[model samples]
Every structure is written in structure tokens, then in C-alpha cells.
Target chain A: AQTVTQSQPEMSVQEAETVTLSCTYDTSENNYYLFWYKQPPSRQMILVIRQEAYKQQNATENRFSVNFQKAAKSFSLKISDSQLGDTAMYFCAFMKGTGANSKLTFGKGITLSVRP
Target chain B: DVKVTQSSRYLVKRTGEKVFLECVQDMDHENMFWYRQDPGLGLRLIYFSYDVKMKEKGDIPEGYSVSREKKERFSLILESASTNQTSMYLCASRRWYEQYFGPGTRLTVT
Candidate 1:
């Protein structure tokens, strides 16, 4: 079984500033994938970014990026130039690299409020 | 772009009542999933289907059942709704590793 942990329950960031949401996971699988999802007030959860365990380089999607330390089993999301639109509940998820039956295990999630 | 749609945005039901939550996807994705979201719990998977007539229990499948008679539609059912079942229900369809989600249904069981 796999478990994801996001210790922070809530965070606040100033607009145009940067913020990092920390996440860690416990998994025995060697090959897997990590993801960050954002759910805004609209209640639509969208994928922010993704990182593969085999890749050394982190994933970046515009203002969103991740610091993936595979050895430490830590994946943190960094939001640069945070905006009001970034205010949402963010979740970290893990999935095995192989097998069609593989499912995602998600962290408790952190509520981020970007204040203007 | 993939689009997933839930039958309702909000619903209220009484205890012991049978509840049905419908989900439909426009894209021809092979896999669909049902998840429940609660405060501080993020999202917990209830059930998933890889194909028509094939269903798999997820992490939290207790008190929940799913039906996938068609490729684009998946339904979640509560045999007898309880107060604890009041939460947000999310429906998603997978395209490879990426899963696209619907707006979600806020179910309140009283």
C-alpha cells in the first residue's frame, strides 16, 4: 500500500510572490509517477504538473514546478508569481508506473490562499 | 479536450434512501473512476471501471457500488444513504496517466 502525506493544512501567500507546498509519500515501488492537482472554488480539480520517478529533472508547467527528490520520496510544488487565481486546494498524488490497474494515492491536501 | 460531467452539482437525500450519482464522459476513455472528497481527507477513490461490465473496488468502496453499462457512463450507488455519506463526489475519466475530473456533486444525506 502507498500513502501520501502533506503536513501543512493551510497556507497563505502574497500575490506576485512565491510559495512552496510540501508533500511526501511512502511507497515500495521503484517506478512511479507523482502529480499535483488544484481544485479551485469552482470545484473542478485540474492537473497542475507531473513528474516521473525515472527522470532526474523536475517538471515545470508555466508558473508551476515541482522539486522531486525520488531518493527522499519527497515531491514539493512551487508556485511562482502567485495570483489570486492560484487560491485553491492542492493535492499530491502517487501512482505506480506499471500495470493498468494501478491507482492513485492522494495526500490530505493543503488549502492555499493567495491574497491580493 | 476531455470533458467529464456529473449528473448534479448538489443533492440532498434522507437517510436509508437509495441514492444514485451519474457520470458521463464525452471522450472515448477506457477507464473511469468515482471518488469522494471530504474536509481534510482530500479525495478517496470509491470505485473504478476499466471497461464496460468490469468494475473494481478502490480504496474506500464500502457502502458504495458502481455500474458501467456503457463506455462513457459510470454510476455510483448507495444502497442506503447515511449521514456519513454526505460529501462531495467526483467523477473522472483517464487518458493514459492523466485523469480529467468533472465539476463534482455535493451530496448531503440527512
Candidate 2:
């Protein structure tokens, strides 16, 4: 079974600063997908970004990006220019690319706090 | 915009009562999932459906069952609610990497 782990339980960042949340996974599959999801206080889960294991280049979405290290089995999320709205619980998820009925295996989560 | 809607935002039930949590998607997505969220424990998948009438058990499938009678609707059934089942339940629909989630239902089983 694949397992995703977010070592940091909570992270704090100053407004306008950058913060990185670390995540690691254990998967034997070569073709898989990694995702970053944000759950705000509103309790709505939102997709932050995604990275494909086969791609060497990291994935970036606006100020949100991921440093996906396939060799180390590490996928970390970087949030730049953090704002108050960026405060949320971030989850790292893993999924297999080959299966049509793939289910995401998620990390425990990292609660990010953006302080002004 | 894609939307996944849960039938109730909050629910309270007795321990022995049968509980049903309903979810509906507007994007006509082929995949729908039910997950329970607990503090510090993250989200644990209970069940998922790839197509109507087809279901699969997830990592934590014990004590939970799912029904997907229609393409847009997915329902989670708890045979008999227990205090341990109290948690925030999130519903999602997706085709690939991006998943659209509905506002979760906070269920309290007493």
C-alpha cells in the first residue's frame, strides 16, 4: 500500500513571505500523480497544484508550486507571497496513473498559518 | 464552475441509528468519492464509484457502504452509527488530478 506523509503538523509564514511544506511518499509504481490540496476554515477542499511523476520539471500554479523529487520519493509544496487567505490545512495526495478507478492516498496534513 | 453538493451541512444521530449522507455533482463526472476528515488524522477514503452502480472500497471501508444509483449522485450509508463515526465527511467528484469538493457535512453520532 502507498503511504503519503507530511512530517510537519503545522507551519507559520509571515505575509508576503514564502513557505514550503514537506511531503514524502512510499510507492512502487513508476507512473503516478502527486497533488496538493488546501482545506480552508470554511471546510471546502480545494486543489492547489499537481505533479506527474514522469515529469522532471516541477509544477507551478500562480504562487503555488511543487518540487517533485521522483528519486527521493518527495513532493513538497511551496507557497509564495503568502496571504491571509493562504491559511489552511494542506494535504499531499498520491494516485496511480494507470488505474481508471484510482483513489487518492493522502498525508496527515500540514496546517499553514499566514501571519500579517 | 464545477460543484459537488452534500445534502446536509450538519447532522446528529443516535448511535444505533442508520445514517445516510448524500452527495450530488453537477459536472457529470465519472468518479465520486466519500471521505471522513478527522483532526490530525487527515481524510480517509470510505468508498468511491467510478461509474453508476459500480463501487470500490477505499483504505478505510469498514463499517461503511456506498450506493451510486445514478451518475450524478452518490450516497454513503452507515449500517448503524457509532460514536467513533463522528467526524466531518467530505464528498468529491473528479475525472483526473483535479477534484471538485463539496462543503463537508459535520456528523455527530452520540
Candidate 3:
């Protein structure tokens, strides 16, 4: 079984600044996928970014980027130039690369508030 | 773009009542999933289906059942609603590794 951990329960960032949300997971599988999802006040959950365990390079999507350390099993999301729109609950998820019906194991999310 | 839609945005049901939550995806993804979101628990998978008439139990499948008669529709059923079941329900469809989510249903069981 795989388990994801997000130690921080809440975070606050000033606008135009940078913030990093930390996440870690315990998994025995060699090949897997990591993801960051954001759920705003509207309750619509959207994908922020994703990283593959086999890839050495991190994944970056515009203002969102990920620091994926495969050996350490740490995947943290960095939000550069944070805006008020970035205020939301962020979750970290893990999925194994193998298996046909693989499902996600999510961490207890961290609520991020961006102050103007 | 992938679009996943749920039947309701907010629902209030009495205890012991049978509850049905519907989900539909337009992206034609082979895998669909049902998950529950609590304040601190992020999201926990309840059930998933890879194809029509095929269902698999997730981490928290107890007290819940699912039906997938069609390729794009998946339904989550609560046999007897309880107060503990009062939480946000999310429906998602997967394309390869990325899963697209719907605007979740906030279910309140009284």
C-alpha cells in the first residue's frame, strides 16, 4: 500500500511572492506518477502539475513547478509569483505506473491562502 | 478538453435514505472513479470502473455501491445514508495518467 503525507495543514503567502507546499510519500513501486491538484472555493478540482518517477527533470507548468526527488520520495509544489487566484486547497497524489486499474493515493491537503 | 459532470452540486438527504450520485464524462476515458473529500482527508477513493459493468472497490468502499451500465456514466449509491457520509463527492475520469475532475457534489446526510 502507498501513503502520501502533507505535514502542513495551512499556509499563507503574499501576492507576487513565492511559496512551496511540501509533500512526501511512502511507496515500494519503482515506477509511478506524482500529481498536484488544486481545489478552489468553487469546489472544482483542477490539475496543477504532474511528474513521472522515471524522469529526472522536474515538471513545470507556467507559474507552477514541482521538485521531485525520487530517492527521497519528496514531491513539493512551488508557486512562483503567487496570485490571489492561487488561494485554494492543494493535494498531493501518487499513482503507480503498473497495473491496469491504478488509483490515486492522496495526502491530507494543505490550505493555501494568498493575501493581496 | 476533458469534461466531467456530476448530477448535483448540493444534496441533503435524511438518514437511512437511499442516495444516488451520478457522474458523466465526455472524454471517453476508460477509467472512471468516485472519491469522497473531507476537510482534512484530501480525497479518498470509494469505487472505480474500468469498463461497462466492471467495478472495483477502492480504499473506502464500505457502505457504498456503484453501477456502470454505460461507458460514460458512473453512479455511486449509498445503501443507507448516515451522518458520517456527509461530505463532498468527486467524480473523475482518467486519460492515461492525468485524471480530470468534476465540480464535486456536497452531500449532507441528516
Candidate 4:
């Protein structure tokens, strides 16, 4: 069984500042997918960003990006110029296969607070 | 653009009651999942359905069961609700990479 771990239980950052959330996983599969999901107070889980283990270039989506180190089993999410809307619980998820049938393993989560 | 809807936003039931939490997806997705979220525990998959009428037990299926008579609808059932079963239940549907989620149903068993 693969496990995703987010060591931080809570994190806070000033608005417009940069913040990084750390995540690590245990998996034997070489080709895999990683994701960062945000759950706001409304409780809807939204996809923030994703990374493919095979890609060394890292993934960038606007101000959201990932530092994926497959060799170290680490996948971290970095949010730049953080805003108030970014306050939410962030989850790190792992997937080993493609398509709808693939199962996802998620970390406990880190609650991020963006202070004004 | 993708929509996943749950039957209720909040539900309170008595212990030993047969509890049903319904979920419906609009994308006609082939895969549906039920997960329970708790404080500091993240989300634990209860069940997943890949096709109509086909169900698979996930990590935490001991006190839960699932039904999927149609491709768009997946239901989670608690045979006998217990106090320990109180938590927020989230439903999701996916066609390939991204999973679209519903506004979860918060269920409480007294």
C-alpha cells in the first residue's frame, strides 16, 4: 500500500508572499502522477496542480507550481503571490496509472492560512 | 463545467439506522467514488464503482457498502449507522485524469 505524507498540519503566509507545502510518498512504481488539491471553507475539493513523475521539468500553472523529485519520493506545492482566496486545506495525492480506474492515495492535508 | 451533486448537504441519523448517501454526476463518467473525511485523517476511500452495477471495496469498507445501478449515480449505504460513522462524505467522478467532486454531505449519527 502506498502512503502519502504531509508533515505540516498547518501553515500560514502573508498575502502576496510565497509559500511552499511539503509532501512525500512511499511507492515502488516508477511512473506515477501527483496532485495538489485545495478544499476551501465551502468544502469543495478543487484541483490546484499536478505533476508526472516522468517529467523532470516540473509543472507550472500560473502562480502554482510543483517541485517533483521522484528519486527522493518528494512532491511539493509552491504558491507564489498568495491571496486570501488561497486559504484552504491542501492535499497531496498520488496516482500510479491512467484513466478513471486508477486509484488515488492522498495525504492527511495541510491547512494553509493567508493573512491579510 | 463539470458537476457532481450529492443528495444532501447535511444529514443526521440515529444509530442502527440504514443510511443512504446519494451522489450523481453530470459528465456521464464511468468511475464514481465515495470517501469519508475526518480531522487529521484526510480522505479515506469507502468504495468505488467502475461500471454500472459493479462495485469495489476501498480502504475503509468495513461498515460501508455501495450501489451503482446507473453510470451517473453511486450510492453509499451504512448497514447499521454508528456514532463512529459521523463524518463528512465526499463523492467524485472521473473520466481520466482529474476527478470532479461534489459539495460533500456532512453526516452525523447520534
Candidate 5:
């Protein structure tokens, strides 16, 4: 079974500043994918960024990027130029790369507070 | 844009009542999943369907059941609702590994 862990329960960042949220996972499978999903006050889960285990280069999506270290089993999300809209609960997820990949295993989640 | 829609944004039901939560995806995703979210605990999968009429039990499926009569819709059911079941329920559609989630339904079991 694959499990994702987000050590930080809560974090705060000043607007326009950068913040990094840590995530680690345990999986015996070699091929997998990591993801970060944000749930704002509206409770809509939005995909932030995703990284494939096979990709050596990290994934970047404008303001959101991931520091994916496959050897260390670490996938951290970095948010640059953070804004107030970034204040939300962020979840780290893990999924195996297979046709039978059942569902995503999520971390406990971290509450990010973007202070003005 | 891919959209996953849940039937209700908020619902309140009594104990021992049968609760049904419906989810539909606009995109023709092959896989659909149901998950429950609680404070501190992230999203835990309850059930999932790969194709129409095909289902699988996820991490926590004891008190839950599911239906997939159509390709785009998936339903999560609670045989007997309990106070512990009061939480936010989410639905998702998947193509490969990455999935698109719905707005979620806040279910309150009294």
C-alpha cells in the first residue's frame, strides 16, 4: 500500500512571498505519480501540480512547482508569489502508474495561511 | 474544462437512514471514485468504479456502497448513516493517475 505524509499541519506565508510544503511517501512500486491538490474555502479540490516518478526534472506550473526527489521518495510543492487566494488546505497525493491504479492516497493535509 | 459535479452541496440526514450521494463527470473519464474527508485526516477513498457496473472497494468501504449504472455517474451510499459519517464527501474522475475532483458535499448525520 502507498501512503503519503505531510508533516506540517499548518503554515503561514506573507503575500507575495514564497512557501514550500513538504511531502513524503512510501511505495514499493517503482512507477508512480505525485500530486498536490488545493481545497479553498469553496471546498473545491483543485489540482496544483503533478510530478511523475520517472521524470528527473521537476514540474512547474507558473506560481506552483514541485521539487520531486524520486530517490528520497520526497515530493515538495513550492508556491512563489503567494497570494491571499492561496490560503487553503493543501493535500499531497500518491498514485501508482498502472491501468488498475485504483485511487489516490492522500496525506493528512496542511493548512496554508497567506497573510496580507 | 473537465467538471465533476456532486448532487448536493450540503445534506442532513438522521441516523439509520439510507444516504445517497450522487456524482457526475462531464468528461468521459474511465474511472470514478468516492472519498470522504475529515478534519486532520485527508481524503480517504470509499469506493471506485473503473467502468460501468464495475466497482472496487478502497481503503475504507465498510459502511459504504456504490453504484455506476451509467458511464458518467457514480453514486455512494451509506447503508445506515451515523454521526461519525458526518463529513465532507468528494467525488473524482480519473483518466490515468491524475484525477479531477468535485466541489464536495458536506453531509451531516444526526
Candidate 6:
């Protein structure tokens, strides 16, 4: 069985600052994928960034990036230049590399608050 | 961009009533998933459909059922609505690699 854990239940960051949300997972599978998702007040879950197990370099998308330590099963998301719009629920997810049989396992999200 | 749509944004039902939550995708994705989001627990997969007429039981599938008659549409069914079943239901469609989610349906049972 695979499980994802988000240690921080809540976090706060000032505008134009940076914040890091921690995530760890337990999986025995060799090939897998990790992801970060943002759910705004609109109730929509949007993909933020994704990292593949085979890749050693972390994934980056604009102001968001990930520090994926595959050996330690850690995949943390970093938000740079935070804005008020970044206030939302952030969830970390995991899935095996299998094509059709892949099912996402998510952690108990962390609520991010961006203050002015 | 991929777009997933759910039938309702909010739904209310009685304890013994049957509930149906519909989800449709416009990108013709091969995989559709149904997940439930609780406060302390992020999201748990209830069911997943890889193709038309092909369904798989996810981690939590105790009181849920699913139908995938068409490639682009997937439906989640609750045989008996209960208060414990009241949660945010999310639909997602996966293609190539990333999964696109729909604006969840918040269902409450009384």
C-alpha cells in the first residue's frame, strides 16, 4: 500500500516572499510519479507541478518548484514570489508509473495563507 | 487544455435516497476517476474507469458504484446516502500524463 503524508496542516507567507510545504510518501514501487495540486476557493483542483521518479532534477513551473528526494521519499513544493491568489489548499499526490492502472494517493492537504 | 465537468456543484439528499453524480470530460480521456475529499483527509479514490465498460475498485469503494457507458462520461452512484457520505466529490480525467480535475460537487446528506 502507498501513503502520502503532509506534515504541515497550515502555513503562512507574506506577499513576494517564499514558502515551502513539506510532503513525504511511503511506496515500494520503483517507478512512480509525484504531484502537487492547488484547490482554490472556486472548488477546482489545479495541477501545480509534477515529478517523475526516474528524473533526478526537480520539476519547476513558473514560481512553483519541487525538491524531489526520491531516496528519502520526500517531495516538497516551494512557492516563490507568493501572492494573495496563492491562498488555497495544497495537496501532494502519488501514483505508480502504470499507464491505465494508476490511481492517485493524496495527503491531507495544507492550507496556505498569503498575507500582505 | 483539458476540461472536466461535473453535473452539479452542490447536492443534498435524504438518508435512504439514491444519489447519482455525473462527470463528463471534453478531452476524450481514456481514464476517468471519482474521488472523495474530506477535511482531514485530502482525497481518496472511490472508483476509476480506464475505458468504456471497464471499471476498477479504488482504495475506498465500500458504498459506491460507478458507470462508464461512454468514453467521455463517468458516473458515481451511492446506493444509500448517509451523513458519513457527505463530502466533496471530485472528478478527474487523465490523458498522456497529468490528470485534470473538475470543480468538485459538494454533496450533503441529512
Residue B85, candidate 5: Cα error in Å is: 0.8
Off by over 4 Å in 5: none
Top-lDDT structure, candidate number = 3
Query: What DockQ would candidate 6 receive versus the native complex?
Result: 0.81
Report the poorest 10 consecutive residues by lDDT, candidate 4 chain A.
A95-104
- State every prediction's TM-score relative to the real structure: 0.98, 0.97, 0.98, 0.98, 0.97, 0.97
What fraction of the true interface does each of the listed models get right, in terms of native contacts kept?
0.75, 0.84, 0.81, 0.78, 0.88, 0.88
lDDT of 5 by residue, A30-85 (tens): 88888999999876899998888888999999999999988899999999999999
Task: For model 2, report DockQ.
Answer: 0.76
Better of 3 and 5 by DockQ: 5
lDDT of 6 by residue, A3-36 (tens): 9999989999999999999999999999999999
Candidate 1 clash pair list:
none
Question: Deviation in angstroms for A64 in model 6?
Answer: 0.8
Please provide, for model 3 over A1-116, each residue's C-alpha lDDT reduced to its tens digit, 9 standing for 90 to 100: 99999999999999999999999999999999999999998778999999999999999999999999988999999999999999999999999973559888999999999999
* Tens digit of per-residue lDDT, candidate 2, span A1-116: 89999999999999999999999999899999999999999778999998988889999999998888898999999899999999999999999883668889999999999999
lDDT of model number 5? 0.92
> Considering lDDT, which of the candidate structures 3 and 6 is the better prediction for this target?
3
Q: Worst lDDT window (10 residues) for model 3 chain B?
A: B93-102
At residue A21, give the lDDT of candidate 2: 96
Query: Which docking category, incorrect, acceptable, medium or high, applies to candidate 4?
Result: medium
DockQ for candidate 5, C-alpha atoms: 0.80
Tens digits of lDDT, candidate 1, B1-110? 78899999999999999999999999998889999999988899999998898999998999999999999999999999999999999999986788899999999999
What's model 3's interface RMSD, roughly to a tenth of an angstrom?
1.6
Report the lDDT of model 4 for residue A103.
79
DockQ in order: 0.75, 0.76, 0.76, 0.76, 0.80, 0.81
TM-score of chain A of each: 0.97, 0.96, 0.97, 0.96, 0.96, 0.97
Off by over 4 Å in 2: none
**Top model by DockQ, which number?**
6
